[model samples]
Target: MATPTRPGNYREQAKTYDLTRGASPTIVRAVAEHLGEPRGRTLLDIAGGTGNYAQVFATRGFRVTVVDAQLAMLEHSARKLGGGHAVAGAAAHLPFSDGSFDCATLVHAVHLLQDPSPALREAHRVLREGPLVAVDPTRENAPLFVHEYFGLHPPDDARPSAEDIALLLRRAGFATVEHHPFVYTDTADGSLHALHTNALHLAGPAYLRNTSFWYGLDEEARRAGLDALARDLRSGRLEERVRAHYLEAAVRGHETVFAAWP
Candidate 1:
């Protein structure tokens, strides 16, 4: 039998995935604000591909671990971390002991899991009385229909909503949690450019999945779809302004002066 696809398989398209979702550094700052000062804190960033947000805490003097199942992505993140530990591990089974760190974070990678409950539970067990942050691209904020039209639903189908996410974290032992919406804006022109870049990156898989139906006219149809999408984007019919919701919850058990804890 074929090897089942795991979270790390996503590394095959890590570059595009990061570009598509990595903008908006504000979200990371907000998470930091919640986690508070990093003095004497240790952080475990689960499935933290390329360590985009992990660096935030690491720079603040916290010992950071960037864990992912993908060697390629872990390698990429290691270059940025510069001697910081980058471990090749699965989120569902983090290679750590209980209360191993001051805090933990899972950014933009939750929805990709086949089972998130185990990972959340692991995060809870590994934290030393601090928050376990989980974040993802909200459905409302994603380029839903456009991506679907292009047969890019494999990843989309993996994403979960805010409500479901909160429930999962609570079950995993997070005492208290809060959900917030993060808004992303893009003008029609800008949105179109972003979409084109995305489509091009997804073209290989999308062509095989979608163009199969238009085999006799695959090339022509593909070009036409691109043209039509561009026209729609330029004509303001594509709904360029995108808004995505993110969740930031502080697990209740730990109490610090002010909601922000070190």
Candidate 2:
């Protein structure tokens, strides 16, 4: 199988993506409820993988436009969200006019962007007067137990800290950019924790199957990594603790809106 190099091609791995990395629907509902009514506003789900967020908006009676750079991702989103409208476009170059949407969001795909500012600007440009939300797991609050088990290190990408995200919103013409910490937690002995650990164990191999770019591991290092994670899981090292912090920004402009991009 050919390796998928772009985010759009993620559709080829969409099923696995959902199985391994899908967010809890309960959490989604909880978070969305905090943002208040979707009513009849139009929402632009930027870099919306598989249309998870877009569908959430739709279910709340909001008109949704799902945008992603990857065609495969858009296809998957369309399929999941009832063949709804989607745009094959980059976050930095949205094909909409100024003040086109009431809300904008980017979920978990910012680190992959070569330039996040332009995407931020595009999001601001497309919104009439609404909040731009970014929902991502913060480095400060990411699950630490899995880091050791998976050989995961700190992020190498340039990310705006939660504070920096609010500053960016202000710079992008949002009037009252505010942040709320959206946290996720599961205790050591909880079923949620077990499921997460098992999923993490499979995620790397699943990603490798789609693309074996694990630094040319020569099969030895690859096996070793998996073995290490497995050992940690069985010995209880993998269940130390789990928590994720999401940053939500309310951008000020034409109309009030709330969004979480992480």
Candidate 3:
């Protein structure tokens, strides 16, 4: 089974991170709504790379402070949102006092941690009776093309489901927990042509360098996967396989938000 590259491995990808990953307005609204009206309250964005979500949250009236382990990523966040707001710290060891934040958010960051319990506990400790919203990818809803082409499969032991995360939240001292599952279908073109284009893009050198799946693969495996994808595309077999995968409902991707309160 394939696992995501460690958080420390993200340093080189920080320069082009914003190009492929940006804050979605829809996700921002969902997280903000769960966090409640900002009311000028302080928000701590844990593992917030480049301050993408932090920037949006600040505009929504939350005094945002972004904490990331990577100095390279923190540098970008500092540049985007001015200096003091970006702090160099680990999620499990946040440099803040107890009950320092009105709310907290972990956006697409749980997978990076080897163990998320400590981080959840830290979040609960720093929050003052407010929500700690976490957005995590649902492995069950991962697109099949990801596994078929990249050979990346997140084992259940490594990637927790929504229910598993809720249990962790409870163990971390959260009293109430709510799950909100959402599918990212707005960009799904639902056609063979769209699948073809997406496959080519995923197999491209730029994606190989930046994406976690490609980063996790060894050099020989990466080369083999790329070569196989190229041959399939040339032989027109890629479209056929993708169409069948879509029919089996393997092309859809979704995520879940776990809102926990202390």
User: Which number leads on TM-score?
Assistant: 3
Per-prediction TM-score: 0.69, 0.72, 0.83
CA lDDT, every model vs. true structure: 0.57, 0.57, 0.74
Ranked by TM-score, the better of candidates 1 and 3 is 3
**lDDT string, candidate 3, 57-155, tens digits:** 888889999999988888988987887999999999999999999999998778778889999999999999779999876545444454545566646
| Candidate 2 residue 37 C-alpha distance from true site, Å | 1.1
Model 2 per-residue lDDT at 45: 86
Ranking by lDDT: 3, 1, 2
**Number of clashes recorded per candidate:** 0, 15, 0
Candidate 2 lDDT over residue span 1-262, tens digit each: 9854543336465545555445445345434654557878888889887677677678878788899887866787888676547888988899888888887777666655655678888888898756666665343332323334335464634334666666666676667765554333321111122234234443345544332124334466667777776665566654443211111111111011235332
Residues 33-52 of candidate 1: C-alpha lDDT, one tens digit per residue: 66877787888889887676
Better of 2 and 3 by lDDT: 3
lDDT of 1: 0.57
Q: How close is candidate 3 to the true structure, as a TM-score?
A: 0.83
Q: Backbone clash tally for model 2? A: 15
